[model samples]
Target: MLKKLSGLSGIAIIAILSLQTNAFAQNIVIPVETQHNALVLQTNKSNNLNIVYVGPTLTDKKEYEEVAAQYRQTDEYTGVSNAAYATTGSRSLFEPALTVTHADGNNSLDLQYVRHEAKKIDDNVSLLTVDLKDPIYNFEVRLFYKTYFKEDVTEQWSEIKHAEKGSVVLQKFASAGLYLKADNFWLRQYHGDWAKEMQPEESKLTHGIKTLDSKLGTRADLFQPPVFMVSLNKPATEDEGTVLYGSLEWSGNFRIDLELDNQDNLRVIAGINNHASPYTLQPGEVFTTPAFLSVLSFHGKGEASRKLQSWARNYKLLDGKGSRLTLLNNWEATYFDFNETKLKALLKDTKALGVDLFLLDDGWFANKYPRNNDGAGLGDWQENKAKLPNGIASLVSEAQANDVKFGIWVEPEMVNPKSELYEKHPDWVVKQPNRQEYYFRNQLVLDLSNPQVQEFVYNTVDNLFTKNPRLAYIKWDCNAVIYNAYSSHLKNQSHFYIQYVQGLYSVLQKLRKKYPTVPMMLCSGGGGRVDYAALQYFTEFWPSDNTDPLERIFMQWEYSYFYPAVSSSNHVTDWGKQPIKYRTDVAMMGKLGFDIVVSKLDAKDLQFCQEAIKTYNNIKPIIWQGNQYRLQDPAGNAVAAVLYLNEEKTSGVIFNYLVNNRYAAGSERPIRLKGLDPQKRYQLKELNLYPGTISSINSNKTYTGEFLMTVGYNPDVKAGRASVVLALNVIMENS
Candidate 1:
């Protein structure tokens, strides 16, 4: 049953295997809006390691009801995950208790986790220990996790992590691999009880950022950077990699291999023109790749990633050049009536979108202007002047005489009790200056550790970037949700969980170190501050303002498992209530922008948004640089695509999508392409059902291939929506 509890051990290892595996096992069924559900885990692997989880008895950490409290009920009331309710314990929520220790002898493995402390939130008792070691074995199952935050409630700690965070390439095992390290820099990064402040002579200066194979040359594909520890001497709490500051800074590492003799449960990868190929795995064979994630730190190990390379010469993305400028967003064309000639006709449609950013969100400096629904006059940043009687530096010099680049929108960490900055700093907000003040969206938060409200939200973005030098993209919105959880900059409530995540990482590292390269994009109310450590200094990530293409295929397949489609933007909306070539082919696999009214799109949806913006800028140099393959199709789930070839195979782009309505009568479904050019031959084009009939495809496995070929994306036989395109021809062979 998990392979007869994988190769036994024990007192015969828990007396003849936990009384013959859960007393002749049986009952283990699942269903109910589940995303992932792996856990048959019961490992103990030879040379006597250790094991014990037992199960249930959570006792309220806030009525965290159950995960496995008496469970043998298949959907007996949508069984678990009411968002796994738990203010305290009973975290089965996707079980885990794996153990793998190897040793030919000379033993030591007394590992005893034993968690049964029902509501242990503050009376504190959730001990997690890892002593893993192995030339042979002391502990090394090495990979298996689940928990994307369960509860911190001001660090009362009911934690769980891993529902997405990446570095891919795990299990091929031609040798040994994998080297995770999380003692948050060996022992503490703003969390507490580093084994009770290990005074073994304290130390600190750990900065990090260097692996992909020594700053760019690559080699890592075994299980992954799994030692994610953060204890900055205990405080800042929020899991899924929350780099709290002041100490401990353990770098990152996730290397892979050691496919413990591959009993292959599946691992077929290569698709979209290595033709008809898509599916992946090898770690109980899972499958999923393409990772750039916001990894705040990870400089080495996995044997310093075989001396890495490729940081892409000074990692820059869009250039108007640092502190650049081109802003104008009135929520996709005035959601609130603006007075100044409909706000100078959207700054004359923002000087014809050529650039010079002009932003003006949330009906301007409140006081019942957009006719107040909330936030009455929000810390008064002035100039409503009857909704702009030519003020705000005359609409910032009428958007610098239409050259464009003006900004405005401030929740200034909120306050709105009908306004006047909470009738004058209602104790500057996050109360305990005596009871009651916690409101969610109607608004309240402020106390930015109070340095006079972080110098009034930094003198209101430095007096609008000191009277606008074309003030750029700062769509830094946060609409609100972290309720009344007080924090007058900490003294209690368990030291306000490291000053509420060090006061939102100190106003986002001082608004990105005083606007370094002003191309910000971390909008909250939209994909709620899309994660991956707010992409180390936010460059771009809106992912969801809900541009709906069948709700962006599970929101861009759950943010393309660890984001990076040129930091993902995807807008192109003008009301395609359903199917506009399947929402511009799911916004041409990212970095594809547009928000309606190019004269309300019609000439065949404006020639399919100009051939989906010239097949997304002719595969914008391989969807902004390639090697992204995300497919898992073994004649199942009919199809879903995300290919991005380009490790010098000249170029690539396979974006495919087609949810199995099954097509066998005249079957034609080949798609096995990934990082192609087994010797040049591609040129395929379908860029949104255009002038069809093009195919060249070639590739015969550099790691996988059969090189498929079958095009007929249903569009009543073409020129309306079905698509495909493959292009290679770059083989400068020199080996």
Candidate 2:
């Protein structure tokens, strides 16, 4: 008979037993450590791995052993242990990491410890793989933990394989599972609709499960992004307490489950949502889930964001070190109503304003169907001969003549019933056999699960680049979400969602390989498909369609929590009553661009626009490649400020916006800066100031960094939608 293990004696016996069995180690400890964080796992006497501790880095092996011993006590009633990779039908009563039906129709899965391996990939990266297997079946699971030492981030995913002769059904498979123990858990999640994306909201986790999910098959970010932040012991602040932040690197249906178990343990399970997706594993088949990136920060959410931004720039994003060009997109300006002559006029204005690129958005395609509106000509990729008798090459040459690079938009993954391509290949759209098809923006989602459809999408991009060698950029847009998601190409209907996303990734990977240097922007009806997986192929993304400066102040602030400013494309548009200078100020915070017709601006506004673009170009390096500090959050404060300091801390820029008139509530308070060299002397100058407005700071005065950071500097922004941008440079006594 087996006796229950407890205390130090139990740990000692388990350690001795581990020496006997090499494959099934009963008491082996595995440490996945970054520079500042550590996640330690150990096997219990029951041959199950459990997360012992996740906090500050533990230096020695003895510390890991001690933590494991401390957690060895079993519950009096349930006797359930907190398995690191919890599975169904084992002793786990909480939400399991995985659930599956075996070949014998048994849904029970009892995973036991098999082995683990650690490998140092590079000077700054390491890999850890833990292997687990069912004691009764041939099913196997391998958990991968990749650590970026300097970034303080660890990416986790899982691979499932089976050797059974018959097929096994996968009901649910999570990308990662994190178990935490704290007195109180506070969660921060993002929620919004089409125009208002990435709005932050915080709430306390009580007794049950709190799920943040997205079921929109393609537009997963339309409701909630697969990201979250959890603070232990108290509400999360910018720079106060311990915070755990993570994001799922997937662009499909995703779900994040935060469960507060009866034992007061918090379990976080995140991955692709299994709503209508149940994959089957044939004999000798293996399946891999998407990666979930996470980091543990004792320095609060501010440091967490910085670490994630650093990791993305250094490793994840495409051309992460490169800067984005300022382009003028014609969507809001021309709106599919321009010809070659009109486009050339816009290009002339773009060059005069010092913008780097000109983007032609939509309505450049279709001959028979004529893309005059969203109801027609989506799948048709041919040039609209009626709109421009000279074709796209003429516009490309015109843009080149103006010394500006050119880009065009394409919605390759969508189709309209009125288009020639759709009329010829109606079977290519995602639809059920007997059900009516649903339309979004008068378009249907292309069935990318079909190899023929995937080939067409890939060629749509390849042919354009092959024809126009001088084409500098591609704005890849997807305007519709998957509605009748049944795919005729899929063998099993349940495999549609997963296969479609895989097919999309395959197309993007091929395009990236072919056009390695060309830049691409991922826009899915505005902020719909902004995930790390899609961002791996694209250089930047359109944060929102609503270019209202007031709305963008809050939207961009929340977005900065996870993504860097370089990956966001903000455009000054004619959508609101805000001043052109105010609109330009908000747009300059990210990759600067213009969506309004330059010719329509008055002389005063146009001159200010030119100067603002010049200022943005001059300081683009500091804004793009800098550490961001949220001096004042726009959630409740009347004055919202953001500071971007370069890595050297010698130069920086500050953007302050008076969100609303608070009747002198926050006017007198000065904005205290961060990430500055306290001992160094610095000089400040105001950039892009309104003509009639007075300067808030004494631009002629030189101040010490210590005084600037401690006493702070007030921009004295006025009530009705005022803004300011200040440039900072270290002062050299020798100069």
Best by lDDT: 2
Residue-level error in angstroms, candidate 2, position 195: 0.3
- Tell me the spans in candidate 1 whose CA falls farther than 4 Å from its real position: 1-340, 343-363, 367-385, 388-419, 429-445, 448-494, 498-529, 532-561, 564-568, 571-587, 595-672, 675-684, 688-705, 708-735
Q: What are the root-mean-square deviations of the candidates from the true structure over C-alphas?
A: 21.8, 4.2
User: What is the TM-score of candidate 2?
Assistant: 0.95
Residues 56-103 of candidate 2 have per-residue lDDT tens digits of 887675777887446533362533346788888866688887999988
Predicted model with the maximum TM-score: 2
TM-score of every candidate relative to the true structure: 0.31, 0.95
C-alpha lDDT of residue 114 in model 1: 17
Residue 612 lDDT, candidate 1, scale 0-100: 56
- What lDDT does the true structure give each of the candidates? 0.40, 0.86
